[model samples]
Target: MLRQVQKQMSLHSILYNKISENHILKKINYVVDFSFINKLLEDSYCKNFGRPAKEPEMMCKLLFLQHLYILSDEKVIEEANLNLGYMYFLGINPEDELPDKSLLSKFRTQRLEEATLDEIITEIVRQCVEKGIIGGTSVSVDATHIEANTIRKTPERLMKHLARKIIKTYEKENNQVLEEIPEVPKYKEIEDHTEAKAVMKDYLENVISKVKKNIRKDCSESIKTKETIEKAREIIEDPKFLNQKGVRSIIDEDARVGRKSKNQEFYGYKTEFMMTADERIITSVRTADGAYVDGTYADELIEQTLKSGMKIEEVYGDKAYFRKPILNSIEEIKAKAYIPVSESVYRIDESEFSYNKDSDEWECREGNITVKKKYYKIKGKSRPDREGYKYYFEPEQCKRCPKHDECAKKSARKILQIGLNTIEFYEISQYQKTEEYLEKYKKRASIEGKNAELKRFHGLYRARGYGLLSVSMQSKLAAIAVNIKRIAAIAASKFCIFTLNIKIFSQYYKFCLN
Candidate 1:
């Protein structure tokens, strides 16, 4: 089933209510406790009022119900009013009044703050760590884009064709009869199934032209186009608004969009997350701009997570992460970067002295490099790019070489400037010529499956909310939600084992009687 019930907490609800009601405050893992969340918001002005405080235990119960049921505050309040199970879960009687929904919205804006969401995610991660859901050996890393909260568009970003339509409006005198004024304000309710964005592009362009003309006509005697615009036109020129759309919401605008593939487009900021191999628990969540290329982003993600106090033994990812920098980082950590090597390098000079096959003579492609100052040194090139890197070619050898077009470029002798680590990793990566090495490279496929699960099942493909903080909160909840589901499955399997053993006992008893 698609799990579409947004808010209905009846007795028929599959998720139970009495799951997290342990008392006595005894040596519990505070990380998963609702009280921890309460503490996060306790300092806010909402709780500092003269009104009677919600009993601490009752507050914890209400929050726990929200977490498990994935309810918005409004939904939770509604369910508590209608459902006996929900009321009972919150330590309220069948007769007690439900809490108001506005309380939560106000609380988030006035008190809870952005850090509370972050703390909730952190606590979930802490619980996963405590439960051994995360291990250092193998983590599947992937990223997705999310739309920014800004619904901004600018005249400059409009297609050249679209801009022409706007300008031509100015070329003609403005008549009282305008082309088509869209509901003039908001497009949130304007989702026409037949509407193409290209149409919106044209509409916005025309709108831009009228607005500019209005600015000119409305201009004051002092500043021409600047002094007489409305609050709306002033908004049209806000540097943040590259373009404009949507009803005025007090937050930023712009639905950042990106493509995962040909038809699989998503509107969201990209989030790169890593999941552990053993239990499929998310280790970290990283949000990237929708525009960053995946392969290049792999190294940045791996570096962040590794620095965040996790021991990473291996990284698994798809072709999007198969890059030279990613592989080199893996080698630096002595962890395997599971990526398939391209087989285009069909022939390599495997001579005895070439890069010292076994004896380490350190030969150049020509024949051998004479050791200067006991180490290969070059001017200007540094660190990973130094020595064994700046390749010096003999003019005599290169002038007649068959592959000189690619191998050397200079009319004289050519010097190839590259990081030694870069070429060395590329060469070492070539050892996958054998089936044994190819088998090791195959683990990357596992992460692709994990990416599918993270996208489809974990609610990460796109989220319901629009802000960076809101989207981040939803993504973190989703990861922990999946982890909690995994934990529940583990618990259920143990219960099944116990029931199976009992069944066996009963059968054995019946057999003895017969």
Candidate 2:
């Protein structure tokens, strides 16, 4: 009976109205990337009421597709509406009332405020879970510098820089000749600073040839350059005290000059994020002032993601997040923080915590005493400034110790900042020996790939908005778009799998007849 019912099933049966090929073609033809647009509309809410309440679902889809394709409002209305593929994917028609860019912008703003920018990201994440797009494995936590639209150098900043150079230039040359004073840009900010070092050099050269002897001594030309750039950097940092006369950067408070992991330096804001390995799903992200340190933000972010209900298993970060204090934090969360050992903690001696040939406990570096195992509550004791805690061999015991110089301090006790069960310490420690930790730990690098996708694939390198808020908003949107793409990819994969299963079943039926 069951087999007969299965055989009677009609493949052509429709779940809803039979969407005509003409209707599909018209909707999709005028559109941009059909698949991405389709993904943007995958959510039921987006499919149902994405457009105005009075507007048809098809029209709403076209507007959203326009947003996904990044077509200007005018372009989306005139060009996209005419294409069949775009129309079909949008579930809209050429005859339907098309939305202008303003309309699109308004809806985005509304949704952004209502659902919030992270809603799309949340949706994408949900899809990833449902489709088995990600493994609850290790994720990489890192940050990238996003260039701000502010000026690094200002005319006022330049004049302050140049005045010192002028004095130094005159002193170094011995006042050999006279030359015209150069105009200084006192307010040039950041990348917009017009005067390069070469121009600065030229100005000094002129001043040197003119008043070489009149200038004072005790400072070299290099000293002058150093002073000028230093003062300029200071001025750039504090915008409230602009001394020069020129336009200021639109953003100053949150923008900072920071270095990336690759050693490339830029003056901008920072974007910290976490990404899973399987599909590179960004689990969490933060936009911070450029002065923000990746190391400083890790612990807080760990807490936040946990609060968000993301079932974290382990976290991976570069040397930056190898905070020793975070180890206990990992334990508290029932998760792990996988940060690498920092070079700053190199002076530590682990011999005491080394493999005690018999007990298998890690010994301290000082091979002095037979045993010195003591655990103290972390709250009352001051945590040393190192990545791990500073524990030591008994100082009195170290006074006459043989490995004193190598392991113990003469006046100080042998202390090591033992990392709290953080995943970073786990890498070199005995933790990775476990299959579960190793499996999750290997996936941390995936976040770096996610960063690359955001910048290279999504065009999020330089934020388009003026203030940090705008930049943050744009960054979140890019994340949302990436999430949308992931959802679409999952949906497409499911569709493909469904088609394959049907094909296999048909083949089985043919064989049975034979």
Candidate 3:
């Protein structure tokens, strides 16, 4: 049930008004009209007839405050009870009782539907657009990683964890400990991971089968036992079960190992977002497993940004977003892509080698030209034939060259592979040399700052709870928090300008009268 609370001015309303107009809480309340939230969440609550529920708006406001200040559930409620600023932000009178902290956890994980979180972000962006704060057409996109809540475990340990969880649940629910349990394997004595995994798998299967057989014939009596057995069976049967990446932990199944760089890896999730350059306000966000490619979400981000009422005239990102499909998606929307070519795809040391566009060959500083070329078509069902080309230099020239050791040590000749879209990338590379591209590309840095702000201030540096759903909500709420902050600053600046104009007009009128 969604209880509608009528807010009449309390005696403390005067004190709330006394909270400086520039106060972050006051500014946020003034700029962000959360009335739309009630309508958006109406379906999630009973229309009537249930115990009077806390207003969805207030519940959501509690969450917003939680993320905005990076407070734990218990801490936020404590602050709201004691702090007048928090009370003003939540729109509750000082005398009004705040809901218990447990209700917040329930509201976040249960009452608030996963899909509604995205709508919440879109609504905020829409408000920004409607308020004329986000009128820019250029948006920057980027992805930041969030560390998983659980520590990573090896495949062997992960299997053991699963087996133990099932057995524990069975024993507790059935109130009978099975004495004839499967014997543990000496996995540490095994040298090969494959052999050890096979033995461990065999052991786990035995344990599961034994538990199922011992369960009372009335298996329907314990749904938890049945569910645990089913979940364990699914994990054991997965194709990637033996691989370390399959299920790192039973607690967080959605998190996966992802590369931050070639040599760096982190187990967690990714939050990809697009924000307007001029306004620095996030327009759209997507959450995915840590291993998800940054470029994969580019199309969705652009689409969502468009849906949020921001016209994207240009899109900016890092080299990871230089894929053909991503660029094509941007082009389809008639937005120019400012993503630089991936270094792995097209990189040449300007001082060492230069490309001759006329001959379609590379020239080394030693004045040697490439003599042979081979086109290696990408063999993939989803990709086009134009993958790239490999250019080979003459072995004889390299053998006789003075810089052979420096340029091609232990090799017969010099070779370079260039992407098939060399022309398009070349044009972008050339444009990268211009003042216009430099100025426009600078907008991409704002997203990095936003990412830092999220991690440093909004508790996005790590997952506060288990599973992707929780992290997704955390990321979106952080985005909303920052957007509200940006909007308030903009509104405050506009107000300052308006006041200055009025003062200037008043001075001019007085001078004329004199």
Give per-residue CA lDDT, model 2, range 385-503, as digits (tens).
Answer: 32333344556776676767765344345554454442234345555457875676666767777787778766568766565666676676666556556555545565569799999
Q: Per-residue CA lDDT of candidate 1, range 333-409, in tens?
A: 88876655433321233442244334423455555342321335565645433354444545666557565675544
Q: Pick the candidate with the highest lDDT.
A: 3
Which ten residues in a row are the worst by lDDT in model 1? 22-31
lDDT of 3 by residue, 47-116 (tens): 8778988888888888888888889999999999998888888878889999999999898888897678
How high is the lDDT of residue 403 in model 1? Answer: 59
Q: Candidate 2, which ten residues in sequence have the lowest lDDT sum?
A: 1-10
TM-score of 3: 0.86
**How do the candidates rank by lDDT, highest first?**
3, 2, 1
How many clashing residue pairs, candidate 1? 22
Stretches off by above 4 angstroms in model 3 are 3-5, 186-196, 212-226, 347-419
Residue 453, candidate 1: Cα error in Å is: 4.3
Candidate 2 ranges with C-alpha deviation above 4 Å: 1-79, 89-91, 103-111, 127-140, 158-248, 251-253, 295-310, 324-333, 343-367, 370-428, 433-440
Total clashing pairs for each candidate: 22, 68, 0
Which regions of candidate 1 deviate over 4 angstroms? 1-33, 45-49, 53-73, 79-97, 132-136, 147-254, 257-267, 292-311, 318-388, 394-417, 431-459, 494-514
